[model samples]
Target: MNGDNRIHLVRDEIRRVSACDHATLDAVAELLGTREINVLAGRLGMVAAHMASRAGIAEGMPPPGTFPGAGNERIDLAAQWNAVTVAGWFVRKKLTAWWWHDVLFDGVLVTYELVKAFVTAVVDDDPSHITRLTLRLRALSAGRLVIEVHDSPENAHLISAADNLISPQVEHVAHHCGRHEHQGRTVLWCELARPELSRWI
Candidate 1:
């Protein structure tokens, strides 16, 4: 088949397989008329490469070294429910299914855990006070993931103490962890470099 026709066929098959409840490597291999899992993996990797290229082309420029203000994107959660709900929403909206499959599946779980810790710290500080929780996700230049948890000025002391407790829970997964202040907000940040995702190119 022609190049365009082949791409169209592959895309259609991908969409079909993605809709399946058990969309595993074996299932994809069956749908694509291939029995070799390695071949299927290589093909999918090529597809991801092409998608990245297309994105750069569509932007009429080379792929950006980093997303604009990526390390500084913040979401403010004003209440406990808001923290949990927003964290779930961010996962669903910001991450693609392909991303979950190719990399960072466990990373999402870690992020959720941290989100819970952040929310709990704020709520425990002063249940009656209106808590403001800020969450930030950034992709560093070295391809590491950095998550920042920020609290309002009123809860600064509580957040600092809470971060000390939270750090140990996440230190096994995070390469670096620390606390600081940003624009008057108390911030706790963690940087992670997953072996599987570190070679993304």
Candidate 2:
């Protein structure tokens, strides 16, 4: 069969098995090929993110947090979740549209969950303590995507707790995970390997 037909078949199968048990999905993904599954997952992630954005806007919520230079800055659980979800969609879309041609589909999902856990931990630990949160994404040299979450330097303990909360989750989808201090800001980061891009070229 031609490449396009094969891709269509694979995507249909992926959709069919997406709601099945994890083992079933894994088996089908293995049979269909990881690259094809990753592409499908990326597309699905974008769809999910778009739905989430529309839902938030429809509910009359403000856009996550103020962007840099917006004069007002605040970060809370709702804002953090919104930012990470939107960022995941943007990153995945950019990969599909640009030179990368590969997306960290599983990684994006894990990062969203991890970000939620991180935000919850902080709020539970001290509801009023965290005032600033920043998330940054960058492509690493070795075909990896790095997501860096930054917050107040004094909240080192909260960062550590978040690291512990998502350590196992991060391991499943990411190659590296750590916490550090950068220019006096506390940072938590995870590096996920991008799927091979040769097929799209």
Q: Which structure among the candidates has the greatest lDDT?
A: 1
What would the per-residue lDDT of candidate 1 be over residues 51-75, giving only the tens digit for each residue? 4433332422222233334333457
Q: Score every model by TM-score.
A: 0.52, 0.47
Local distance difference test values of all predictions, in order: 0.58, 0.55
Clashes per candidate (backbone, < 3 Å):
0, 0
TM-score, candidate number 1? 0.52
Global CA lDDT computed for model 2: 0.55
lDDT of 1: 0.58
Clashing pairs in 1: none
